[model samples]
Target: MSEWDAEFEVESESDEDPDFGPHGDARIDHAVASGTFTLDGQTFDVENNIWVVGDDAECVVIDAPHDVTEILEVIANRRVIAILCTHGHDDHVRYAPDLGLATDARVLLHPDDLPVWRLTHRAPPSGSLHDHQVIPIADVDLRVIHTPGHTPGSVCFYAEEFPGYPAGVVFTGDTLFEGGPGATGRSFSDHDQILESIRTKLLTLPDATVVKTGHGPDTTIGAERDNV
Candidate 1:
């Protein structure tokens, strides 16, 4: 087993109901769960959000944190088409390979983060995500926005009028958070780059755009625009 398998634990499971929208095409169900893991002797909490779009039987998974069991349970009976990582952080991607294998789903990451991914995962991802790339999951088309800084390959997935989200939703991995942009104290992290990313890529979105962060509660593009 990889060190990831031995070091992480599913601390809890909390299921939130999917937000329903007006049109059937916009009706996407989603659930969020969290897991805990230790890296370099420090414990970190990670959140994994699963989105069920189109036929409701097919789905896309974002940020494969620890607790594969919980993630599996959340996606039970559904066919996962893709596993999209926001970046290459171990805390966010530790279970991606196993989860992808279990679901036979394609794993995707930014090419710039391949080195970070190689630090923990032995195999390369199924593909690479680039700016403005559109990922079709069921009836939804998630637009990839490459927001570097937190990591060279950090990205955020954006979809408009998704389910209960009228304005839109952006799955911001560790790049942009509720309070401010993600930390830049680690290797390959740049404060200026992250700030510029937030300004040009994220903050430019509509004010009401929902910011589904990788680790905490959601925020809006407007809320963090001032901070940026």
Candidate 2:
């Protein structure tokens, strides 16, 4: 990948990567049950958010974020059945191996994002995911939507009725966000392709589908479509 394609050089990396860019609506709320944790940056400058699902019996973590110890401490109270990645960004999977070892949970991702993951961890995706594939992670039933844009294998996980909520929820890694979508400046990334993916794959979901973004606060498909 060229410098322009892989360069996500923000001035300073934080627990959260700044705030959501300009593509967000002021009215929609961005709150969800996903928890945040920290991690160490050995191979890369790992900095991102982590999300957790499930209640007392079992739970699944979305995005490793950074700081393995912190992530384990945060989810220490629950039984983690699996770990899922939206994409293979460094910050997203820095602690996945340790987390999976700690919980003995299966680590899963799209086959396409495996290369990106291997660049950091030296291994490919533990599992394979295809578009419209439904994966049951403990209590969470995730439908993998391969909306490649930010990366060739970029995907999002959607639950028709996310645990306690009546409306469906989508875990949009770096693909579809509140304000707009992820950057598609790489050789593998196509601007028109990502746009079309969002318009057709994501925007077609229910209006009330709650979106738990990879970086910033959560929003809904309806809001982004309307705001844009």
| Model 2 bad stretches (over 4 Å) | 1-47, 138-140, 226-228
Please name the candidate that would achieve the greatest lDDT relative to the true structure.
1
lDDT for each candidate structure: 0.75, 0.66
Expressed as tens digits, the lDDT of each residue in 1-228 for candidate 2 is 323112212211221112112221111122222333222332323235567765545666887766667777667676676677887766677778878887887676767877677766886545555676555544445677888877778888888865445678888888877788876665456788888889989998898888888777678888899643
RMSD of 2: 12.5
For candidate 1, the per-residue lDDT at 112 reads: 97
The segments of candidate 1 whose C-alpha lies over 4 angstroms from its true place after superposition are 1-55
Model 1 deviation from native, Cα RMSD in Å = 9.5
Clashes of 2: 7
> For model 1, how does the per-residue alpha-carbon lDDT over 6-113 read when each residue is reduced to its tens digit?
221110111111221112253445667676644445666656555444454767788677767777776778778678899998877888899999999868788899
Worst 10 residues of 1 by lDDT: 8-17
Q: Tell me the TM-score of each prediction against the true structure.
A: 0.82, 0.74
